[model samples]
Target: VTGSPGAVITLDTTAGVVFQLNPQTFPALDMAGADDIHLRNLSGSEFSTSVNLVADITTLADGVTPIGNNKYFNLVIWGGQNRTGQTSHLYCNLPIGQYGKQGDAIVDAEKFSVHTIPNDFRGVGFLIGELTFQFSSGGGGTWALIQERVLLGHFPILIPGGGTTTIISTFVDSSFEIFGNLDDTKRIAFQADSITTGTTRIITMADVNVDLADIATNNAKVSNVTHTGDVTGATALTLDLNNLGTETSIASGDFLAMVDITDSGSEKITFDNLQANIVKTGALNSGSITSGFGNIDIGSSTIDAGTIDGTAVTATTQLVSNIWKDINALDVKAEYTGSQTGHADFDGTDDSVSIADREEYDGTGVF
Candidate 1:
């Protein structure tokens, strides 16, 4: 039967209607005017019919020249029928119009099936599919089933009210790039058994929740870190101070913060004990001089003192050992020599030295 363009033709073989056609003597059936031909069989008995569909490509201006060479035609079958208990075969004849290349020709085929369940089954409506690729080597080579993937279980579900659709699968071997921004409500979550084995490129990680175990191994890989809280540890943390700049001078009252090893607490200390701890070499500019409980050895340096025990001090060429004797004799003479205005002189034979009111010197004349 001939029909208009894009018309669907259905052959219902129910109610004991016999449809028969012989492939050997029947004429070629052209499918250029029809879009699809569906055969429906609702009867319990088998319906045997054979139809040879052909396309007349020789009617072109240059016969069989418009169709590309070295191309494989693909046949797709899609339906909503439950074929869980039935086994069927599909047969087709593909004519090779021309051959131009000497390489292998590959054909990629895909099948899609949708399964509908009851509403009480958690709304579990899913679509399951698989992809297959077949190749034929050389010209007019026998076609072979190169690979077949059977997708029996595991399907992706779609929500009803435009919610998030979740796909549960054991493994996914594909790459994806998402251009849409993800907020708090929209996010991707991986289970405990899930792992990303490849490199993931993320621009910013602000407001992203990451567990401590996720980055535990990558702690050493960080180049820099800034922390506002205190970082405490059970043991001591050693810091390398070799890169610190040198300090030229330290002020007098400035203190240093240090950890006291005695009590293991932080404390502040001044530079009071610096003189006894460090070796002195340079001249002191301006500071109070005090005894360091040791002998003072001024090596070739002059000791300029203003007064020594409230007495006028002077620089003398005498030795320091003999200068103490002169200092002792002058102390006694100042106590005995009273106010004598004139010199008392007498002859050497009967010379007597006396004072007018002193009786101790009158009886003891030794002239």
Candidate 2:
């Protein structure tokens, strides 16, 4: 093909690769005929891109205005500002005739790519500042200019800032850029929203080695503990905060702390031995304890309401311990046995009773 005075021409062929001679071409090419193609805009009625797009981020901006305070990096601005007309495209060759249609937008249309800031702008070492943005695909017709947003990427790592700060974990349905710092000393700023509950979304936190003495029966938010959101489950950190130890003032009710689970009162929570100033009534002892007491388990002394089976019983002035007796030594008898009988009435002066069995009694109360 050859250049004309004021007219343009297009040539499309499928007879292998066409090589044009430098000195002179075949005949002056005429593309007006039905057998030829004309070069024109790749976009249709709606201007779609012709090839993959390159979006260079040069500056950071507080607001997208001409006079807005903008931070430029290597003469380029990021945050979708100052990058509209600075885009370049690497086009893909398309045989428009390959598909039966007149032309495929994607064939002539450009693919898109969100480019990172030039390595020169990243700097060698870390300089501390705050940075954040959200990224998403607007639609399929962003051809004239590359639209972009910020996301967590090669940017500087963010550190945990405020201890009382609270933020939604899930950013609705959009992209969430809650990237924390690489340092292990940092923690999350707030409760991250998990759209799902139970099994779907899981919120993770640092494990805590609990010191039981620090946790109180009513309040457990002592130490460096800070909870930004509600927690559920046995393995959650709340379990460690909950004080399972019993308190004397607890009014006939169960006590649950940060963790909802608690040991049932119906079950037994036994210890090696109970050593307290006031020996409170236990499950085995149905009666109430009125005075201060000493250790009951020590010195082989047993304390219980029912018949206890142990060594001996000793009582001090303020201490009273139950004497456990063996079941076999219990003195028990019926009112009357079938073979044995005793007189109902006794002589008033002598005060003696007659038994039908002569051999059953000794001379002291001879039958």
- Maximum-TM-score candidate: 1
Query: For each candidate, what is the lDDT?
Result: 0.28, 0.26
On residues 197-291, what C-alpha lDDT tens digit does candidate 1 reach at each position? 67454457769786766443545464334324344655554433233333445454322323232324443222232333323444455655688
Error of 2 at 319 (Å): 37
lDDT of 2 at 209: 69
Error of 1 at 88 (Å): 12
Query: Per-residue lDDT of 158-272 in model 2, one digit per residue for the tens?
Result: 3122111134343422222232457523422333354455556544765986565645443444554444444444442322323334345533332433344344443333333
| Residue-level lDDT for 81 in candidate 2 | 15
lDDT of 2: 0.26
Per candidate, the number of residue pairs that clash is 0, 15
RMSD of each: 22.1, 20.7
